[model samples]
Target chain A: MQDVPELVAQAREGRPRAVARLISLVEGASPQLREVMAALAPLAGNAYVIGVTGSPGVGKSTSTSALVSAYRKAGKRVAVLAVDPSSPFSGGALLGDRVRMSEHASDPGVYIRSMATRGHLGGLAWAAPQAIRVLDAAGCDVILVETVGVGQSEVEIASQADTSVVLLAPGMGDGIQAAKAGILEIGDVYVVNKADRDGADATARELNHMLGLGESRGPGDWRPPIIKTVAARGEGIDEVVEALEKHRAWLEEHDALTRRRARRAAHEVETIAVTTLRERIGDLHGDRRLGALAERIVAGELDPYTAADELVAGLTDGA
Target chain B: MQDVPELVAQAREGRPRAVARLISLVEGASPQLREVMAALAPLAGNAYVIGVTGSPGVGKSTSTSALVSAYRKAGKRVAVLAVDPSSPFSGGALLGDRVRMSEHASDPGVYIRSMATRGHLGGLAWAAPQAIRVLDAAGCDVILVETVGVGQSEVEIASQADTSVVLLAPGMGDGIQAAKAGILEIGDVYVVNKADRDGADATARELNHMLGLGESRGPGDWRPPIIKTVAARGEGIDEVVEALEKHRAWLEEHDALTRRRARRAAHEVETIAVTTLRERIGDLHGDRRLGALAERIVAGELDPYTAADELVAGLTDGA
Candidate 1:
């Protein structure tokens, strides 16, 4: 159990073990999370975050591994957070994906971690940003947040990135599925992965059509680009990386990066605030006050609104 | 708009339109929600809540419709709340499912509504209970909450029910998929819908084995039964209904029903309290204080935890 300052100092010195330790603290919601966050606060905001998200079997892991290689080849320290919001059992379900990413496991400049909500309060909304900050502060020039599923949580996580890459596979009804999952609007770059498969061109064309159907942008606005990739063979990945770099350049040119980071920060703060208050409410359960109110609610003597009013008053008054 | 008392009275008298209006008010989080909840307080708690949850294409809608028919045969008023937590666009994605449910639309004894998170604070956790309270107060003898997708949100909603039924279709790797989705432990009953499909028996057997692998229960504990149904043709629905009734009886005999309801009430209250605090946080964003804090965070001058602390302090002080 190292002190927060020592752990953070080692992380800053490019120690992967130290970096992994800091992330573990944040991911587990360790009691010293506040100290760790405070120590890392001044060192964050340097890393470029790119979120890779899509449904299962879209080759998200393979694409992420390819991107890691691309970034590392250019001499940039990279980190990948393979987040699985769908799996409550955390690391177990993502074991196969981690094995897929094991090529980077031995690289000193690459860090890879898998995150699940683990039934935490505020779920991924509360945890992912903290982990991202840990990586950002650890001197990772680029952080890839690859999420497993295209549920609402995944969409929210993807939108937190400076640039989001939405992936699709051909012949899966993925164009309509992506639109239905609401990932169509959140992507800065779209990749029709497994390009060697049938209907790859159709998938790309349909995605192009869907992106065009979104709100029309001004001349200076960045249009999301669709790239086709056969990630397993590492084909067309350089183009994907090129698209990412272009999007990043556009963001910097437009000063949209700062605004996006601020929005992300605001969301993170709100999630933490709500989670803090929720913890207090959980404490009320231990003191029997919440239980008493719940009993009354079930007895038909009190409505939930009135019971909540009392609980909120208790929280504020105690504060 | 009609007055709250008039609406409650009409709902109590089994006026379907009045009941629908009341639910709409709660679902929308109308300003009059507090008044409506207060009015409906004494009339709730009589309905038996059963949660039906599974992945998409598992015949959840068909099974739900079948249950509605079986309950109607017993002359009990029934309501179904088809909740889709994954779809941010609410009613549009659920429109087809509603059409499939239109067979009961003309029946005065049946009420069906589709609900989505709609980007609401506290999400389905906040809205579902309030909606359920409205349905319970509206003279419905049974309320079925059918959720789309087998994600974390759906799992949470299912666990909130007094009797949760986890559904599966044969030959979809559904048993393992259900386990990965974390729905295995939440079910009070399991149904293998589309039982006419191949591997129905295998699916049931695998589910039974998986359920056995979980922590063993005592002889007095209620074992969740796996029922097979060809839901589209309304086969084996009577057995499903019987299983639900037997579970309910066991719950009452063990006094677990009261505990479950009280737990549900506690959760509802906590959600409301969190949501109320979150609305205050949202107000801070309007006042520019949150924006200022976010800017500082993005600048790496402050950590999100500290920002959240200050926000929470302001909330409590103002209260």
Candidate 2:
């Protein structure tokens, strides 16, 4: 219930509970969450945020787990916000992203949490950043956002990161399914995970071919190196991390970090606007005047614009 | 540029060139186009728009072609607007949807045209409906709006249709993907395309289970039957037509059709507003003040909200 500023202050003071609470409140969209988020906004610019996204079985979770483990091994603090869309039958979901990095749960060096996409609005409107804020306050030097790989729309996750890593599996059928897909363009680093598998090299070669074909989405000599990773065996985790570091270097030089944050902030505002406007319309359901008008409109007795004006008029007069 | 009233009139008078030109002109942030669309607004409700969407390789084209042919066989004139996403480099695409219905194309009873989903916000937002309007006035009883398959961000097509058919392919590992996807919940009819493939029965049974588990989205008793179809063989097209007719009857009896059209009207208006706003920004691109602001925003020198507000203010202040 505390204001976001005070909560953010506590989080910056190294309070894990405070950071977690901020994240939970934002996810829940608690009434006062916005004011709190605004207060904490200024404290969020320090951490390196990397987003990992790919198809469902492309080893996103495994790659994330390996990278987090590597960062923790370097004695650096890290956090992971693994996003998954929840099931209709069960409201709760198991965030198995930490399946490979289980030791971190017992070790103090790493923190991982799973969040839901919640509903049809597939993009990360605010959940990812709010989680990032918590990670930043938790003193994590690096935070990784791993998308559930539903494709296309989930590209929002990568756009939010300082450096984006797009994951691909070998022999995933010529990678033709992804050839013209704009999702691959969001990558700052491409990882051919399950590299130990047959045709993994083929996937990598195809990715390099793709990188050569397009107008670069980013500046610099950042070719979005394809780091082949046997994530299950930790075979190429170091190389993946190296590619990530190279991206981080580019961000530092251009100072694109702030602009990235600014872009996300704008998107957050737009999404909130759209969702809020629609939500407000629901509150006008009961008035008979609007009801009759809706009925009449449905009965083809009146035009939609005229009907809408009449419906809103009742709300306005009532207000 | 004689204006929307005259253009809509000419389109109604069977001017194909006028209809195409109007749709192109109206589909952007151009003030003139918005003015024209507003003038032509009251004429949109006469079309029975059927939107068909599903994942790639689901045989959507084949199914659409069959339905159009079926309508033709029933002696009802039909118009098909198959939207295809273009290869970013080619700008040209084969709307091969006609391949399945090539049988009827020369009959003078069917009109099938493939429309491109112009990238970065073009056809989907504007041109589509204009094409629909032309078809509506051309004496077509059924206008099929075959949306370009945009996975995840697909609700746009549903919002625009009187009836929406969600086609799913069998053997797709993600039955759960479609179920929780909000797509299952939106469809007025569900078709299991490629039913000859292995595990088709299981996919249908699972879809039935999921459908049974949820509350219906509207006032329709039609359970969106899982019609099996090997569209390539022209199989089950009759069942698809039957399902569509059942939905039409449900809409007519329960008066959901008017409400559906109203909502579609609202969406069309919003699309127009957004498209017009974007075009306005595009037109003023050469203005030095806006250019500097855009450079600063993209370069991470300033937040987009601040930049956007300044641009809006500058435009109004007659700067």
Candidate 3:
């Protein structure tokens, strides 16, 4: 198992089995993942992460596939983590997201991993980033994290991405409601996927209206060029890629890239820091006195607030 | 502010103004909240947390109000944390669920506090629990944490409750879908709220199927009871309370309550541990070495994993 570093090296050399095993090891939270990452981290930064997110059934996966195909044709390797919280026991998506995304399974340039729900809330908070780190280390030119269905975390995709594309389909509902999901604020490039569906133009119009409300954000510095695409048929992908490049250029032009990178670094550290804290808390449950004190508080012999304070500082109370 | 301990004592003496002010201090993460909690912790465990959650607009608030009414009539003081994630700028809900819960406002026995979602992920991650602790310390016999819409952190409700009642509307797409949302496994008592709507039986049946197909794994002395309710007419409030009591008793018979309490104490302490670690990490963010290391990592001359390790250990190889 110490050869995990060698395996990571082989995985980076594009060995299919090695790559699969490496991802499995990382996804399983193998302590060895740290060793692999330690060896592989210097090889990363070649990949740019693009987060595609929207409501369920919004064609995010299809749009992602189309984008993957486009990127592959442009001679770039891509990796995708279609994140979902499905039934862990059945290993089945109660939603058809994972099945639909398996379309690119046969592609040589594309690596798609469907992550299951892990032990905690907040979308397997560490898995997606760790997976992206692996892909980045493995020499993918681009990595795409397609998030779980729309909500608070959905809007977070923008913060995670160097280029974030909020995927939308016209037929689901009103675009204003979608905008109110507040996903519109995060979009560097707007993608109206499933453009052939009816009411696409109206959604686009409404989206523009919502975006119009942000004039105080300083004069449309980033117009969030909306690209219409029928992702199932692979249309409008070039323009999407072109728009991404334009955004990337804009990021560099305005020094936003430096700021964005700094923000990403801060976020990455915060996630790791918070997760470490959670793990430490898990370890402290073994203290018998603390446990008994807690029971007493719950039973009303002592108070919870005072108990919590004492419990925290008890180890060094005399110090 | 430093007189928070005095305020807490006043709250324990049943002063409503003191209770509100104490909870405000707690929910807003004021430094005084710690002092208040230090005085109030022993007072907390008397209140049983009853968590009610389901899809948005599935009449959760209505169900909660009815339950509060039932509990109040039973001579129990009730507090409801109607958790609503607010718009960051205005601190208002996307929709005012409190308006729907207006019927309970005039009742002195029932204290309803509508919490605005703060910087903390719509109050679920941090603020709501702080508010709940205040309510619990203030001697509310039962605390109902009505969810602020389901998502990543919202699922934390399962851990927060002594008895979780997962509320569902009839034909809420499919009962199996709720199971995927981790709802089936969370509830000790599942309420098919709005059973007056057709397909309530179908939903119950599906949930039962899910439970039997390997979700429920308690001592197995008592099944996770499913109660049917049409909360609007207060038709099933008594039954829901009955089910809650039954589950509570079952836990005693099987001694699962001890295990459950242990879990809650561990979770609470774990959150504190994590918060402390993050504070420690935050203290290092402005260090000169960190700035240099971050620059190197961003410039592609250093890897983040090594950078993180060095940052944590305060190691520097730079001359």
Candidate 4:
């Protein structure tokens, strides 16, 4: 309900409430979303986005919490956007995870928000970048996006980040499972969490082997480092952070960071355009045009492609 | 590349190879797909689509196989589109399941195809209805769409059916899980498979209670029936078929079948239109316009909404 400019100003002044409100606006797809985004536009592009993702039992939350602690220790303003793509329910199901992250609750430099994609118009794909932008504009030096599951959406969300960290535990058949989940291609830094457990070394070795199998890297290319960590005990997390920094440095050196950000922006713009157009098409459902076309298709008098052509023409002509 | 007309003619004449080729074209998004869809248009709208879905261990494939046998016993031509949304690998990963479905392989009245969403451009959403169109045109009186997971996509595919059948086993904590998965809202008929198991009655009772809790049906509304079936032994399969037929009759009597089919066609048209626009946007990536807009957004000179507006304008203007 606050003015967009006032909210953006407060967010930039390091008010966590304002930051949370901005993200809520994004998640709710508020009518003032455009004004808020415009107000925050110049304030963004300052934060480094790191996406942490893996299977359910691989300690993604613990690893993310540990990373948050490490970043806070380094005197950086950090934001964690915990995204649960699998849950249709929003916020309530993630209350326990938020409680686990309570160590940073009182810290002014750390802001945490949990998002669910079930009721969002374009799901996580459309809402996440905006949420990240809100955090970036709120003066967070590092933004961590943690996803709950290992589905296709998780991989996609992770891939949208400037750096993607994939966590695996020992003896989970994770190496091959990661390959099957298509996370192997998106990870810039691989972390073997729960290192104190047995078979950790073997898991790391298998992951290393799998990473090397088909990828032929040219000189100057970044070879993602595998870091082992016992996140529950806060062990080996610094090395994970170090690997992330090294990857970021490599990306910057090769100008891949600019290209990657551009690609991510392009995807965001495309998703917004497509989502907006889809909404317009949905609006046409109340009109008889789309219904008549559907009836014709159902009556076997028109093919869907031809009908789609007519619909597109109508949309463009109206525009 | 066989000619589209010749392939459609052969497919309508009950040639399984032609049907397979047509589905392949849909899956591949072939250059001649428009021609094929136009050719298949007049022959579709005959097959009644039924979607079968559930969790991985719920014996969905077995139930589907039993249904195929029941339909074949009735001397009706049937086609099964087994969609796997979880597997990133295509037909190769589903070959084993195809072997499980081999009972109907030699039957001239049955056609089976396993599709994976990983490599497809528009995923299962865009490709599924087209594949269903192909099967409908191939003279199948009944089409069963069986998905291989309990994720959001499975729920979506099932909801697209004229009659959605939700399968559950006895002892998997399935009653509550089904509610959480949003399947309870979509099923027109519920099947409690593995009825010989110990908790069969309890599962059915729990499901019935859950289904009754929030729903306020009117006097003439179609109340979903829960059937117990030991699909492995073929027991209670006829009841499931009868339930499906009754649901179909109810749909027809209420004129809901025409409305459902029209709604499905509208969805198909919208998906095609969006997919075509996305391809055009992808083509713009090589032209530097999209890249330029992305650069401005990344540089904080533009917000994604404004960038998206420009992109949409370009697309519509070009159109």
Candidate 5:
């Protein structure tokens, strides 16, 4: 392994390979992870985290690419973390993501990484925030976390970011489906991508109607605005960036930024603590405690709830 | 708080209200859950568990209704547990489901229950199996576990059943999407519903083509067959029943049924144990241990990994 101080120095200087290696260590949960995180901790909390999520075939990748381009043009160092918790293989989707963002691959100002939810103890919910910390500490001005907006993990990703952008496209019947998926609650800014399509106006109208239906945010509460974008052609890219900036400003003005970061830190700490406890329980597998409990449950000697209580009592001290 | 013995007896006699009460206890994780489960344990393993899952808007509820009708025609008692882990209100989807299945709602031999994933410690993966036990103990010859084929929870539902049926519709591009969601691997039988639609044949052809791409099962191993049905009009309903029976027989003949049940039990046990430990940690929230650990990590005095290790040690007796 490379020296932790030297790697931290290189990463802070915006060396792509050094940043990549640090993220790898974080993802792999290496023995030196503590030292690496300790070195990076002071430099963290500088970059703004933005999350982009939407249903599949919704042009999320294209929209994300346009945002990266817009940020680069503004002379900001940007990082992209493409998170796919469902797919284990990085071959198909990651390859597609790379091909879509190939234009910026050679640009040193942009760092792109694809992370799958394989082999992670706490799933993407845990791995993503740590990766965000790495990028934030590595001197990036902005970081984008893009995940497929399908399940609970997507919601978790949205909560991890400073600004959550929910992307949708026209003619996908996504407006109603989005409501069913709880997308309306998590999105800070809604994007109707593929605005050049036929039903783009209808989709945007429906979204506005639904947003109106939500219990109105109180006075001074930020109202999420809908924007239309033809991401494939790079149209409306500037408006999306501007909306992000406005949301950030709103978050700061309302003093919601500290509250959000505090909530995020609490979640991370809980996840790590819970994961560690589960590992200890996992180590008890071959031991007689869990096995005896399972036997009693299987044999109808006790219910699983009781067995679980007994097992927990065995693991913990009375206090 | 009825007497557990009397409630179990009433449940075993196929009393609708008694069955409903037991399932509610399971869903609530009530204090009496353990007693109820203990009473129901011996009566489980009698019902044939079938899981129906597919993308939304694919007529899953309709197909489930058709299956209930077909099973009733065969003089077998049926129980339907519509497990919707995503929705909380149970207002829209469950109401629609109740209306669709109203035909069987009044039948003495048919019991239908809707379960939402709200406020469960272990989520649907833990709740669904216990609910199945309640239905199984109620003397139902067949239990249908229906879930939307979207996320990890759906896959967990599939594994809990003896036979998993993957439902798809024509022209939804669901063939490719199902493969991406890992739905293809979990299904023991595939059904292309809405077979009267325009692209029914194309959908079936694509499913068959994808099935062919998989590695060959050994000789005498069961190969999942793709069947077509227009479930709304009851068209081809008999074929789905026949396919399910064939798969069940295949499982029984190969000793796979026991293996599947064992695997399900192991998963349930592990989930319960892990959840119990998490609850203990949740109880530790107000204690200064977690707060101190968080402060150390946040202040860069310790990495989260090491902090987690220390927190775990603080909980255990060094065993």
Candidate 6:
């Protein structure tokens, strides 16, 4: 493998292979990940990350492709990260997204990656943030993170973005499911894709009604606007892009963008620290300490809670 | 609040209200949880935990109700725990299940509780195991843990069970999705609910075919049997119980039961330890140490990886 700095430098210079390698390092938790993150640290925070999430079969991939085309037409660099954590087959859904996005495969101004978290520890909840950092440091003007909102981990995707778009389709029962999943709170923009289909208007109306049921939005609140789009045919792509830009302007003027990014950074830092602790726990698997504690719990000599407290105290005492 | 030992004694006497209060304490991460766990430790490991999981609308709740009735008829004390982590609206689905299970409400041999992961740290993955321990100590001969298998946390439910039953319905696209979600690997038994509906046999056949595709089971390995049931009408309920007993016997003969419980205990203990560490991290929220580290990362002076390492080191030093 090439040196971390060299790979990061090449990635920053818009080398697709290098970018791919950087992401692979992140996903695989390679030994050089620390060095790579350090090298990319100064170059980060340049990209505007937009999270696109919704239920399965909601045309998220198609919509993301349309948005990428629109952004490319506006003469800006773009990156697409399709994060699917539900499928045990890591790349199955991503391969489908890749076929749908083949038009931009050859575009030098666009970078597309799919992250399936089949075997990755901490899953996408841990990897996506770092991957976003990599893409941001690589100088992409706009980074789109597309994820299926069906899984719990997917909600974390929205928190990573500057503006989160929640997509819904007609007759999918996604409206109520989305509400129950608590996705309604994470979205900054609501999109009803496949709007050309029957019942699209009804879906939109239902979404609007649900949004209205919540505590009334104050003047200072950023009320998420619902939009309709036929992503397959590129219909309403311009309006969607306009909404994103307007949201961006709103964020900048209100200073929400900096705060959001800082919160995101804080979360990332905390996640890494906790993940390190988890790894340390794993290292104790073969050691006698953890095994003894578990045995004691199982033998009814110590409660799991007290044993857990003791274990934590023991692990941290040597620190 | 009552002391932990008294509460445990009350809960173990099959007092529903006491059980409810004990569970509430667990859900709230109450300060007395350690003492409660200690008091309950010796009383656990008696219940035969059966996990019932499937996609939504797959009749999981219906099947669970039927199974509870069957177990009760056999003179075994039964408890039902519906664990739903994906829904923020806690108890919504469980209310319906409670209605379906109303017949057992007045029976002293049956107890029911619904657990939602709303605001619960580590979600159901952390809470379900402890909840199972609580039920076990409550003198239940059989504990049914029902959960929706659509999200990542559902897999952990299977891990907690000695025997996991995966339910399916005809024409739900669940067969393939279940495989893709790797449910096939977790199931000890498979049930095709709504067998009176069309495509029930086809669903069973498809599942069998998929199971056949895996590395063939050896003579000593337990092969998951696919059975069809119309749980709404109480049809095939006896067969399901028979299958469960047969599987339980097989587990004992193969000495898999002890190994499974041991593994479950190990997982539960590890989860508690990790959760405790995470809480410690959360306590650092308002502290300047984490904020300072994030600031340095954002400013490009320190990489998140190195900063996380330093933070973990600092946190663990005085433990």
Candidate of highest lDDT: 1
- Candidate 4 at residue A224, lDDT? 87
DockQ of each: 0.61, 0.14, 0.27, 0.64, 0.27, 0.51
Ranked by lDDT from best down, the candidates are 1, 4, 6, 5, 3, 2
Tens digits of lDDT, candidate 4, B89-203: 2252123254456677668888877776646557888888998999999999999998754667667877889999999999899988888888889899999999999999999
Expressed as tens digits, the lDDT of each residue in A1-319 for candidate 5 is 7798998899899887788888888777787777887787777877899999888889887888899999999999998888865432132212334467878767889888878775757877877878888898889999988888877876788767999999999999999988887777888999999998999999998999988846667889888889999999999888999999999999899988766765576668778878766766677667777766665555556666666666666667532
**How far is A305's C-alpha from truth in model 6 (Å)?**
1.4
> What is the alpha-carbon interface RMSD for each candidate?
1.7, 7.3, 5.6, 1.6, 3.8, 2.0
- Itemize residue pairs with steric clashes in candidate 4: none
The list of candidate 5 runs beyond 4 A from truth reads A50-110, A114-121, A144-152, A163-256, A277-302, A310-319, B54-76, B84-106, B167-181, B189-208, B213-217, B225-250, B278-296, B310-319
lDDT of 2 by residue, B1-319 (tens): 4566677677666455555555555443344654554445445456678988776677777788788778878888777777656311111112233346557645655556666555645456566665565566555678887764454334566547788998888888646767556577778888888899998888888888888846655544656777899888889989989888888888888887877765565554344434434444555555666656645543435443355456554433431
Predicted candidate 5: interface RMSD?
Answer: 3.8
- lDDT of residue B236 for candidate 5: 84
CA lDDT of A273 in candidate 6?
A: 84
DockQ of candidate 3? 0.27
Please give the lDDT score at residue A249 for candidate 2. 78
For candidate 3, what is the DockQ-based docking class? acceptable
Each candidate's clash count: 0, 4, 7, 0, 0, 0
lDDT of 6 by residue, B188-264 (tens): 89999999999998999888888884567688888888889999999988888989999999999998887788777
Candidate 6 per-residue lDDT, tens place, A113-167, comes to 7787647557788899988899899989999998888677788877669999999
Off by over 4 Å in 6: A53-75, A84-107, A165-184, A187-243, A286-289, A314-319, B53-75, B84-103, B148-152, B165-183, B187-220, B223-250, B317-319
* Native A-B interface contacts kept, per candidate: 0.93, 0.04, 0.32, 0.88, 0.35, 0.74
The sequence of per-residue lDDT tens digits that candidate 2 reaches over residues A1-319 is 5666777777676565676777777677677665655555445566788888877688777788789889988877777777666311112222233356555566555666777666523235556666676577557799888775554446776667888888889888636655545567788888888887899888877777777845565545556677888898999899988888877877767776666655565554444433443333445444455566545444445443354545444333433
Candidate 5's chain A scores what TM-score? 0.90
Candidate 6 C-alpha error for residue B95, in Å: 11
- lDDT scores of the candidates, listed in order: 0.86, 0.65, 0.69, 0.85, 0.80, 0.82
